[model samples]
Target: MSVNTSNELRLIWVYPDLLSTYGDQGNVIMLARRAQLRGIAAEVVPVRSDEPVPTGGDVYLLGGGEDRPQVLAARRLRADGGLARAAEAGAVLFGVCAGYQLLGEEFAGEEGQPVAGLGLLDIRSERGEQRAVGEVAAQLDPDIAGEMVEGGAPAVRSLTGFENHQGLTRRGPGVRPLARTLTGIGNGDGTDGAYHDHFIGTYLHGPVLARNPALADHLLTLVVGHSLPPVASWADRLHQERLNAVLAGKTRPVCKVQADAEPTGTRRHRHHAPGTCTTSPR
Candidate 1:
């Protein structure tokens, strides 16, 4: 069957068994709702054991999981680099929690071993003994972070979410953060989040997309290519306003403990204004 243009965003959710932490499935529903609001159809494909990863999806989501699941999922993904190729093709890939950890070249588990990654993004994760959990507040880069702010296009209705992770991801050869962890940054070494091209990886939880509609729109834009507009129409505005109101109820205060914990500058890379691209730190 030919793809319908009205709702033509293809999404692939890889390894639910090895992924899916803290109700990550909610993310799928949230994304679909946003797509429907914009009058676009979204197709979400799930990849399990021994399955060949599909190509040409508008976006990919990888969620968090435990040690056993992470090992199994990593093995499956590393055996074939199809996801890497699709990402190289400019497909928007969003990895969260365990999903975020899998996108890196490797993650160092608790035993201090390097687990294989899809090498889709320039970062590495090392497992930690403790889990980073609690509500978080973050300052996003204006250019990339603005749309998610309140009252902005594709606005983020909630500024807080649960961050649950046991490892920290260090910036490898390339990658900037989509948001920072106010406390540990999820990168065991105390880095926040990382970004590369259209790829965004983070440890934040509570169906993050539901709280960050602008991010959902950004992902949808990648999924549909730049052809479709966001849900900015009158009807969409009404829907979003209602959604924002619902989110207001769920909004929690950012953990004050991490507030003063500015992420340590691991690299002396020059800072550039938002929107402009900077080379990944050395």
Candidate 2:
């Protein structure tokens, strides 16, 4: 689980061909750029369905895809066993939307039939009648936020993104959510994402990392194996500008769902949940 001897950080972009819906490949680009800007040599390796997943990667990224592709990706991942093995060896993973759903125990397939997942996370996703799609903003779990940024200058509190999904995830016992929903329907359960061990799964798209540079750096820190000194760059400026625009009330096209149809535990405003990094019993 150490960086390659050549001093290059190996990042595996999992199944990009099958899971690049919503411009998720941008996440891999963002991760590499952030590492490069900080003087860390990084190499991105795209793992497609036809290839074996690389176990030497420091970080693995899986993006959203259509239901059929998701089911296929799930089956391929289960058979390859590379992601599971890499995670066992302490590699970090970031799964988004359909990718996020596939990390759990199971998710509804294209026909609403249950499909087996990689089971890297202790959660299950079911297809819901209402799809959650819109501009999403969530308050980061305080403890996770505290650990993400260097110098503790008020860790990035809010995560902004666009969500478009129909899977409603129910967290298993002891699972901690990544954030609390501030604007859109997240997980259809008030929570926005799931975080356990070194794995993070979310429905946020906006190619999430680009809009949340601190998060990108946080993941990079894991790969580089140390606290990285913060650098103010064009990426930071762009992130702030986008955030400011979001806060200023500029919004994107969002799917409409009846208010009464909202999930029971979700709230219209932010709610602080206790943050814990404990993983499911192995």
Which prediction has the highest TM-score against the true structure?
2
User: 183-222 in candidate 2: lDDT tens per residue?
Assistant: 5677876777888878899899747998888888878876
Question: Can you write out model 1's per-residue Cα lDDT over 1-282, one digit (the tens) per residue?
Answer: 112233467778877766886787877777877788777677778777578877667677888888778878888777767677777777788888777877888876546688888787887777655656544545454446653443234544323345766776667657766664333234543345678778888777648776566667767665554533545544345445544442343333222223355445353221222343222222
Candidate 2 runs further than 4 Å off:
150-154, 252-282
Q: What lDDT does each candidate get?
A: 0.63, 0.79
Question: Which residue pairs come into collision in candidate 2?
Answer: none
Give the C-alpha miss distance for residue 255 in model 1, angstroms: 6.7
Per-model root-mean-square deviation over C-alphas: 8.5, 7.8
Report the backbone clash tally of model 1: 15
